[model samples]
Target: MKQFGAKIQSFFNSRLGFFVLAIALFWGKTYWAYQTKFNLGVAGSMQDFLLALNPIPTTLLLFGIALYMNGRKSYITMLIIDAITTTWLFANILYYREFSDFLTFTLIKGSGAVSNNLSKGILGILNPTDFLVFADVILLILLLSFKVIRMDIRPIKKRFAIGVSLLAALLFGANLSMAYSDRSGLLTRTFDNNYIVKYLGLNAYTVVDGVKTAKNSAVKANAKASDINSVLSYLNKNRTTPSVTYSGVAKGKNVFVIHLESLQQFIIDFKWDGQEVTPNLNKLYHDQNTLSFDNFYNQVGQGKTADAEMMLENSLFGLPEGSAMVTDGTSNTFQAVPAILDEQGYTTAAFHGDVPSFWNRDNTYKSWGYDYYFSKEYFSSGKNYDVGYGLKDKIFLKDSAKYIEQLPQPFYAKLITVTNHYPYTLDKANTSIKQTDTGDDTVDGYVQTAKYLDQAIGELMTWLKTSGLDKNSMLVLYGDHYGISGNHKKAVAKLLGEKTFNDFDNAQFQKVPFMIHMPGLKGGINHTYGGEIDVMPTLLNLLGVKNTGTVQFGSDLLAPNRNQTVAFRNGDFVTPTYTKVGSRYYMTQTGKEIEKLTAAQKEAVNQATNRVTTELSLSDKVITGDLLRFYKPSWFKPVDKKDYSYKLSNGLKQLKEAQEKKKTSVLMKNDGKSLADEYKTDAPELKTSEAESASSSESAAADESSSSSSRSSSSSAAK
Candidate 1:
């Protein structure tokens, strides 16, 4: 016993022990992302404990580099410098995820939802102290493990300290070169101020400014007249609060929101086995009021899908303009859609197939005015996971509907589906898995998920009818974004059965799927080039609910005079507008009034870009666990809570109300409000989600090859 104690003490005294401990501490964080197929509730288990026993492989892989370091005359000093730098990076991302700190003052100018807004939000909230503590723990453990010890550095000469500083500077420059990082002009300024100018000999000022100027010039190149008109009009209309509000007759009607993962329109265009991948969707194209918009696009620049949905639902845009879901922690969303419903005495709830906090969604949903959040944990299912992370969509839908249908008189629900989540492969032979993927079973899993989605819809509809609420539901479904970025070119070619080729990913990247299922309403089709942001305004317009949330970034799709236009940014460059006609552009920024575009285009591009960037930046804040104050006073729907502070004094009103309410509804005739003769006086025939009235889906027998034939048949049958 005495010998063991001595051994342990000796280990702690050795320098080698502390090095191992530090490495282990940093690596421990890998377990936070506990997702793997065929595993249930086994997070941070064997892997966390066992990884250290077999560090041989990692050590061998880096042995060459370490050996090279040994050849240097200043190997010990260089090692210390490199170690500290690595530790810094680890602490920045792992401990804080940069949730509270903004990087550059200049880049913060734009109110965009993308291009750079999200990136800024991400870098802002980092906690250096947490990581440093973790580092300290590591050092403490290393000190206990007596391996080959290098000791006594504080007593070294002053010249040695300077040499170490120079080495650190060299390593930092190398890191900058190898990191492949990009920054916005404003953020770049901050980076220069903090790291580049002080540490690197280069004038970070010139470099950052050059980047910003270059970006501005590149954007100027991607402009159009319609774009210019839209932006300038927005600016003219007041950059602050909106002057106009929408009102309609959607009272007493049940609202249903379904979020389809990775849904896109290009599914209808992309060929699959010699035909369209989404033949059913395409065939339904002309069945409704198709707008065939000349221009409409998604403004989210990065973190694509999350950015897409956050901006749409919150009436906010994405980063560069603001922050992203995981980076920004200062978003203001409590004044969005749910708040509108809450004013009308409607019950509000949100659902997701994954952990509620994965993207900081748990906190953000409340700001949108939801009364309850249903994440995987709350669902509390006993079924085993065939694939990791959450329940299958079919099950979630069937189950969630049961819970939602029981809400008070009126309700607003956000259902975010996840069966179609990425990592596209699943463990074989897992009977519990609804959307299982085997190595050779790609199509089967996806197809099964589609069928599962249909089943989920069917189940939800059944609940509505059985619950005696069939005629009072209004439903809307939209894609979060395209499925995870993969080998799109290869997938497209495979779907089309085309010859193998290099470089060609079709417009399928921009497409997914969307639908609005408004029960008790007349059935028709809508074809407007609308993004998610337009959904709320469009809904409010239909419901006779006034719009309190309008920021020149989006307009009510039903508004007749509204221009359906959108812009996208690709790697620092603004992409041309993506319209129903397809992607095309021929514009310049100098205000030249060519028949195609003019100076107005420049203004529009900047405004739109700025809006998106701001949204992105803000979204990050929500995802990182901070709530910004929302002051939109225009939200006066009947169901909304006039004061959110009832919780501070009342202690837990929202939670109590949620538990007490059985169900709720909002509608025109039900609320005794008069229906508007037209949602938009100018667009008397405007299509809306209220037109979605059916229950069961007919997606089953639909096939790509028979798309055209089916459409023609359906048309003839109807005629």
Candidate 2:
């Protein structure tokens, strides 16, 4: 006891002993974290963990161990290593242009997280993971004091071994916890969000989160099971409600909606040199009465590209925050555009290049009412050439053609091409853009992929014309989101054209292109901006078919009433977030908002956000495929459509804000430095073009948009 007390006393008294212990534990914990998230999907060991700790600590811990063994000379080597790690961690948080823990709002609040440690001078010895070492140093300082310090410093065989064991245990614990934490975030929040409000405290959190999760899960299952009863009951009561027949196609008229991967709209502009990149699309714009929706933006968070589909086709919003569609376990719920077409006697099908299971698109399509689906695994294996990720665009198109031949008359087909995905390499790998942009894969790959996609589109268009379907069918295409193409500016510049392709939606991402080609309605254009969510209903209205608005949360752009805002979710969240509110027919993204919006404008924003978010309540249903055979018109209700824009109230509201911002900027600039109020703007010029388009559509929807009396539709067509 006396010796143990003396050792404890010595640890508190000796800086050298305390420092060594901190170093040992720091490196140990770090190595454990690194190993946890490495490639392995499992979180059993330290190394198998996903999202492991930063690597700085491990390096420093080794240095400390060396110092303890050798002598003061260790400081020279240790300092060099420490300097590098510190700087890197500091910079990581600072720039956060790339993802870093410090940059994330979710991670910023954790205790023991490090900051302000990066330095340029320490570049030589520090490995990327070294900074984790410094964090341990700090953590030790925070947790241990005098007597406790000695507890960490003991005999080399005993104390050091114990510390190592302790580290492994803690590390394993943290890794498991981390994985659990993510699952818990989604499971717990979902439980709380779903039942906490309705069932009172019965849905309270249970032990180890298992109780609440179990009960909550059961509730969800029960709730979903109940949807059928409710829907069936509703159907019986509403059986008297007759469905309109869908024979609207005038001869060979067909519409094709193609969703591109991460193609933002801001990729074109004369100023951006985008004119050449999308020459064909641009050509279509001017030659055909093409309406380019300039302020069109996607607000999908997480599941970035898929979210575009969620919004565009199903009028569904982004997923919940922190949960991924890939990991959400529970599939999303909702009806798809195919259901309506199936009722109308059109073949409803879906096509994709990746494993249908990746995003659960396979199961999801069934729920969305797709009568047929072609996923990567089940795609015709005999088809040949450039088998990059899963299948090439050319092959995708070729495969699509095969399906088209077998498709029923007046079919509604959705083809999602995936050749544009990362690594951007093709059989004919083009590297011209790489020379100019240096380190930008976004540019290099985008140019190559965009060109490839363009060629494919041209082929598809040509085939349609040759097949004699051109005059009878409509074609629409768009991108999911902008690429994280290693080089943003150079890649965007190359693909969109340095001049015109410069801006798509806004500087946040390249604006996605939404192309609409209708049979018989050829050369007719509406420049009004919209997103994926609006596509389904808009098509129904354009085809002049009675749209079954079951679970729809978007305005029908083609209806022409043009009074409701088009809403989108940023594709970065698991839950719906980052709402984009454009005037029902407006295309302006940038302007001075000096004053706050009036209550009316606020209400509009609320309406748009809520209308989109309400879909989250049933995302699980969409993914589960239970609702494929059933849907409701009221579920997809559009906002109140009326010509309220340009009213004195809205104009005055905007005018007021502009004046306020102008005044504030002047006030702040009085000092030496200039201060300007900044807000995100896609552009202010697209509004006029949008208006021209909207005016035209206004004539089309003058009657239908207002006649919101629920008209029913069913997947089953009784012969």
Candidate 3:
């Protein structure tokens, strides 16, 4: 037994054994994180096997520095390397749990400001088993402290260490080349970070992000306002006028814009296993009070939902690659919807269940002229209440009633629902729908959650009717973007009963639901070809608002003679006749390729292509150059961010102050009560008794103070 113990100790104390041990520990933790923490998907291919082992070369190259050092210095180097790698792995695990994305240099640079706010939530993302990430390091420390392993003074030959590093570097090159071969043009194209992490590894993703960040920083720094002038001029010349009939139709009505997360147009009236996918949405669509667009497409870029937001607000395109919300949101100026509405005697508020800083929205919303921003701080903090994104759809809509009612009348409010977001996870208890098992977990999960979102929306609509908000409010509902990407189209194709998915099918998949409902209005399905950028102008026309001098790229869909060439951020376009992606133009009705086009068809395609490119470039120029700051419209007023703060209870504090000043708060209108009381739900997160208790306590305190003051005055008189 003593001999066995001595042999084990001797092996661990040796140079080669220590080196191998270090590599094993680092790789073990990284691979564990990759499997357990991240959503890297099923490892069913040779490429997947390679990706699982991708961290090895990088780890070896980094930790090999220990071999060049001697004695305690070498040991110290190993410790430092282990600590850094462990910390990096742990941080990414937490970040991935929240965002389903790897950490970029841009995100890390902005981390400090948001870290304190997100720390508690960060702790929640971790599990008791996650301690294994540090278990190896802790074991080493204990072993050294107890003399279980001894350090030798001898150093490894410098030449051998250098050779090993060179070998690792060569292996990395081979790994990268193989990955590129497997997923052709993997690094060159602009794609989601998931592809990068799935092909290479987390370490490769960080390096790629750093390079992209540096390039973007240079591009931003060198951009000039002069570069935007030509683009601006083109838009000014091409901008469409408002429809004569619809103008002023919904004037002075409250606007309730509900952002349906990851909803596609196909699911509007879709059914699965004898259940409607979105029954409430279908009802809203068929209602005489609503105007639904059958061909409305989502033209979002890399920002996805955030891109849709920027388009709806500014009538401008998102960046062609990354998120404009993060890359340019803080610095660029916007002639957004909220700011425009603010000029028309409207109060603006945005309610999102996710963290305000998720897309740098906390600061961007301030500049966008939102009067109040309710985010994660305002939602239930329980783990069960949150699914993939933030609060569950039920809790988010119900709890928002408390803050929603407080907004002044004729307000512009946006409710972003995250229940149908990617990975579409719903607690079994909250779900009444079942998956149809289409051989894709994502697809199966998608149907169930989409049904859940529909139910939640139905609940909200019921409350709106019961509370009488429906009559005076114009509800604008739109899907942010596609729920599934092109990668998963095969499974979706099966679900849709299509034999094969093609480029023409891809175009159809981009369609998202867009509807506007005003209680007394005549409504029907409009067959206008439009995109998210067109939404702002269409809504503005209905509200009797004008974007006369602003360089909006989108034309109003309501206009009888509106331009129908809806441009995507990637230079694709869809018109009434055709869908143009790159050099290929497909017939809209038949989905057939035009092998030999007529002169007019060719001319139209060329014109549409140019228009799409020009629009995207100009939008990029506006964002990258911060040009809107140079070209402020006459009616637009710069937002005063001092009026709002998202610090703990700051929104509630502002409401209280407004009520005290008799500044026409809904709470005061209701005689010092919360509208949440009207919303009758048994959500465990809602503590109505506690809220009532606090209200009762306030009245009790007021009476006690009056008695004490009277008693004190009587005593003074006696004296």
Candidate 4:
């Protein structure tokens, strides 16, 4: 036993052995980061295994050069290198917690506000076990301090050090080549950021991301205003005017936009266990006052839900990569819907049940000219109020009634729901619907949460009607993006009773719900092929608000001569006849590729492809170069962000002042009282959770007691 101990001690004391130990430490730290920080699935798959092993060659090549230095210089160099690498990994872990994405040079360049915005709670990202990453350095320091090991003065041979580095380099090259061969077009194709990190290591992903950012920056710097001529010409020639019959139908009405997160069109009337999955949405879909679209596709880019927002508000495409709101949105100029409505005597505010800074929205909303922005801080943050993403859908809608009732008349407001987000999970106490046992947990959970969202929407509509706001309000509801990705296709296939899921099925799944409910209007399902980009023009036209001088990329969907070709950020397109994904063209009706095409058919496909490519390139340049700053519309003025505040404490006072000044607020017309008193709900959370139920009971008792006191005072005065 003593002999074995001595041999282990000797191995640790040796210079070559310590070098090997350092390599292991570096590699181990990287693997730890992969397991903890990223959500890249199992380690059993060959692709994932290769990614786990990727940190080795880079670490070896980096540390191999340190061997050329003699004695303490060599030892200190390795320690410094290890510190830098460890710091990089630690920083990425913190960033991934908020963004769920790796860092880019663009993000790093604008990281000035990151530190100040970071709350101490972000440190929760670090686990106690993470400290083991520094164990090697601590162990080395202790042994050297006790004089248990002495440094070797001899230098490693230069030829040996160089040879080690060269071998490592060759291995890294082969690793990259194998990754590319395994995932076809791995380095070039438009894919999810997660795929890049899963196929290649985070280090390699960062390097690739850096290269792409640089390339985009270079393209923007070299672009000119004249490059927009073709884009402007195309838009002007194809511009769609509002239909004479529908124009001014909902003029001067308050607008309420309900953003349904991750909802798809299929859920509109989908049945589960012989019951309607979304009964509330089913009623609205069939209602005579609602104009719903069955063929509305979500043309979002990498920003997903935020991309949908960008298109709906500004008729602008999101960036080809990261969210425009996070990347270039803060600095770019936009002729957004809120600002346009502001010119027409409308008060605009946005409500979200999450922190303002999560997606850099606190900064971007100001640029969009919102008069007030209410985030999660304004809502109830008490027990049982929040779910995974933010506030529970029921609690969020209930709490928002307080502020929504106070907004000045003719307000343009938006409510963003989050309970139906990805990896959907609902507390049993909150959920009343029966869950499916579909083997796939996500798809099963998706149905329950989606049903919950429908219930919340029903409660909101009831509030609107009882509060008397429904008579003069236009309600717009839209699904932000797809709920399930291709990863869950098999489960979705079983749910839909399909034989097999294919690319066509995936493409069809991209359809998102878009509905507009206007009181006393002729409404029915419209089968036009439109997207989120067309929303702005359609709403503005219906409200009798003209955006005559704006540079919008989409035509009004309600127009008599609307353009129906929808272009995706990836250069794919969908028209009434054909769907183009990459180089292949398929019939939209049949989803089959055409082996042969007539001359007219080929010409039509070529024209659509050219239009899509040109539009995407122009949009990219507009965002990256901040070119909109140069194009000032004659009727538009740049928003002064300094005028708005998101602070919740002063909310009541702000609402009162606006009402007193205008004398046009609906709350004032209803005798200086809030409309939330009329809101009725039987949500399970409100009934089952003690905290929520107590709060609701207390509010009701207070209102009743106040009414009783008022009657007694009036009777005594009469006597």
Cα lDDT for residue 457, candidate 1? 55
* Residue-level lDDT tens digits of model 4 in 196-302: 66766776777787787776667667767776665566677767777778888889999999999999999999988888989999899889999999999888877
Off by over 4 Å in 3: 1-212, 272-275, 343-345, 423-428, 433-446, 484-502, 581-583, 638-644, 658-662, 681-719
Q: Compared with the true structure, what per-residue lDDT tens digits does model 3 show for residues 617-685? A: 778888777777667567888765444566546678875665565445456677767666677554544
Per-candidate TM-scores read 0.54, 0.50, 0.72, 0.71
Q: What is the C-alpha lDDT of each candidate?
A: 0.44, 0.46, 0.80, 0.78
lDDT of 2: 0.46
lDDT of 2 by residue, 343-444 (tens): 555656677765444453533454455655665543544423334445666556765664454444566778888766765665443222222242565455
Q: After superposition, how far is residue 272 of candidate 2 from its true place, in Å?
A: 8.4
Q: Rank the candidates by TM-score, best first.
A: 3, 4, 1, 2
Better-scoring candidate (TM-score), 1 or 3: 3
Candidate with top lDDT is 3
lDDT of 1 by residue, 198-261 (tens): 2221123235545744554344334333443433344346333221332354565667777766
